[model samples]
Target: MAEFPRTDVFSGPKKTIKTPAWEPGYIRDSKSGKPREIPIIKQLYDVLMKLPRDTEKVFTVPKITLVRYFQKALEGANIQDFRFHDLRHTFASHFIMKTRDLPALQKILGHYSPVMTQRYAHLTNGHIRAEMEILSAVWTPIWTPSEKSVPCEVQKSFVK
Candidate 1:
């Protein structure tokens, strides 16, 4: 297996976000009672790699702060009725559509169960339909192949 670089990010200090005390090792994943390993994308890794050596935390911001920034970007893009959480939804939808790997996506998204990730399955249905249409266009249909005297096993394996 190829080695992948890891970025150690200190999510927050020894404190709770609700009442914020000296509670250690608590991040958003603590709510789910499980630790999650989120993958570092190339662009994020490149940007994070630029942080100074003395930096301990990768990013430290409240949800409201993130929402404020997201809203600004939304205004610039002329997008409406979009929340900060919608970004996560959009990413999940697209990831499922591209990879068609739900289990991997579930892990990436830090869902407790695969069922939690099923909401994105509907989005993938459209992708599957589009892919099937492409297959129909590129290769002849089953009826056409059968009429052309194609072998059943070969047709079932590749053409179908």
Candidate 2:
């Protein structure tokens, strides 16, 4: 297998957004009772850290405010109709292209089934084709001509 060069640098914010002690019960856990961890991007962390802390409110800002902020950011970047959820899609798409480990990717993405990872399988067509080529070489068949066989003589007349 060919080795790929590592790309991309994580050089965003140094700030951290503290989650409130009490969150809505429904959003507390996934179906499997595992807690969901929201990754804090550097830009988002910087913005969040600058905001005044609100002890009274369980959440720092309303969902509408977050959506508006994301929309405005997308508009500024000249990206059309981009939503925050699209970030997850983008991560999955890029990861699939670079890595062949679907199970590990599925776990990282919190997908219940590896089948969910199949959506990105088409992105690694080059890798898949290369794998097929290797397999085809290993499993190639060898054919040889067969020798003619003599017919067996019947001895049924004496028995009758």
TM-scores of the models, in the given order? 0.59, 0.44
Candidate 2, residue 150: the lDDT equals 25
For model 2, residues 57-159, the per-residue Cα lDDT tens digits are 3347887998899888888889996678777777777777677678767876667788876764455577679778889988955533335432222233233
Prediction 2 TM-score vs. true: 0.44
C-alpha lDDT values of all predictions: 0.64, 0.59
Q: How many backbone clashes does candidate 2 have?
A: 1
lDDT of 1 by residue, 1-160 (tens): 2122344555577543232211123223434656555666666666655555432344556668878888999999999998877777888888888888999898877876899898744585678789989888889654433445657665676744
As for candidate 1, its clashing pairs are none
- The per-prediction CA RMSD against the true structure, in angstroms, equals 10.2, 15.0
